[model samples]
Target: MSDPTALLQHTETRYLLCRASDIGEGEARGFGPLAGSRRKIIVLRRNGVLHAWRDACPHYSTGTPMAWKTDAYMNGDKTHLTCHSHHALFDMETGQCILGPCLGQQLTRVNIVVGDEGDVFVAGPTEEI
Candidate 1:
């Protein structure tokens, strides 16, 4: 049989986000599958690299957003991602929870692809999360 994995490959949807330049170093922005949808995600630009994560707080059973302010998901030092609700900290480079509640847990990393023209896109899970 043809490899089942190969058959299902490239099937996930990749949604276009914003330009790579839009998110500056040490900055982050939030996006969702649709307007007025509570399901959300946040992307960060650190050291000129892009990292995407589901905007969910593992500390909270309901999985709430990490930012207190819009698109402001970093700690004061801009070194790690912070959940404003309970101060859960996560490693921006790896999305692993480094401090606060849910320690050792991690922020769900989204599969993102940056185009040659600097456009950002998330592959898979196009529906409202």
Candidate 2:
């Protein structure tokens, strides 16, 4: 898999961000340059599957690049990503804002595929920056 950052820098359509071993089960790490933009992304491992979504919180878009102070986490149930800024909970599988002040909204989903070699890479269309 190609380097994710380098892919972004080179404006490649897609690239690899992490190895499967880099993320522990039920944990999430942040990455960036989805679709070749500056926006950050949250790459998560849930129930043995790898998923990626825009890191911004829906309530106020406060995570990663937007607000460096905010903290986001996977819910204790390991089913959703919760933003500490406003307690908004997003569905882990779909990136939908399922609870809190922003119900009906969602974090932008980024297409990604997990390679047989345990690498994770961006796979499809990039969401708007």
Task: TM-score each candidate.
Answer: 0.80, 0.70
lDDT of candidate 1 over 1-129, digit per residue (tens): 788776456533456778889888888999874444565778888878998888988887768888888888888887789999888889888988999989998887888888788878777665534
Q: Write the per-residue lDDT of candidate 2 for residues 13-118, one digit (tens) a residue.
A: 5577788788787888777565567666778878888888877776765543322343336655666787665677787888877888888988878777777887
Which residues of candidate 1, in runs, are more than 4 Å off? 1-13, 33-37
lDDT of all the models against the reference?
A: 0.80, 0.71
Best by lDDT: 1
lDDT of 2 at 106: 81
RMSD of 1: 4.5
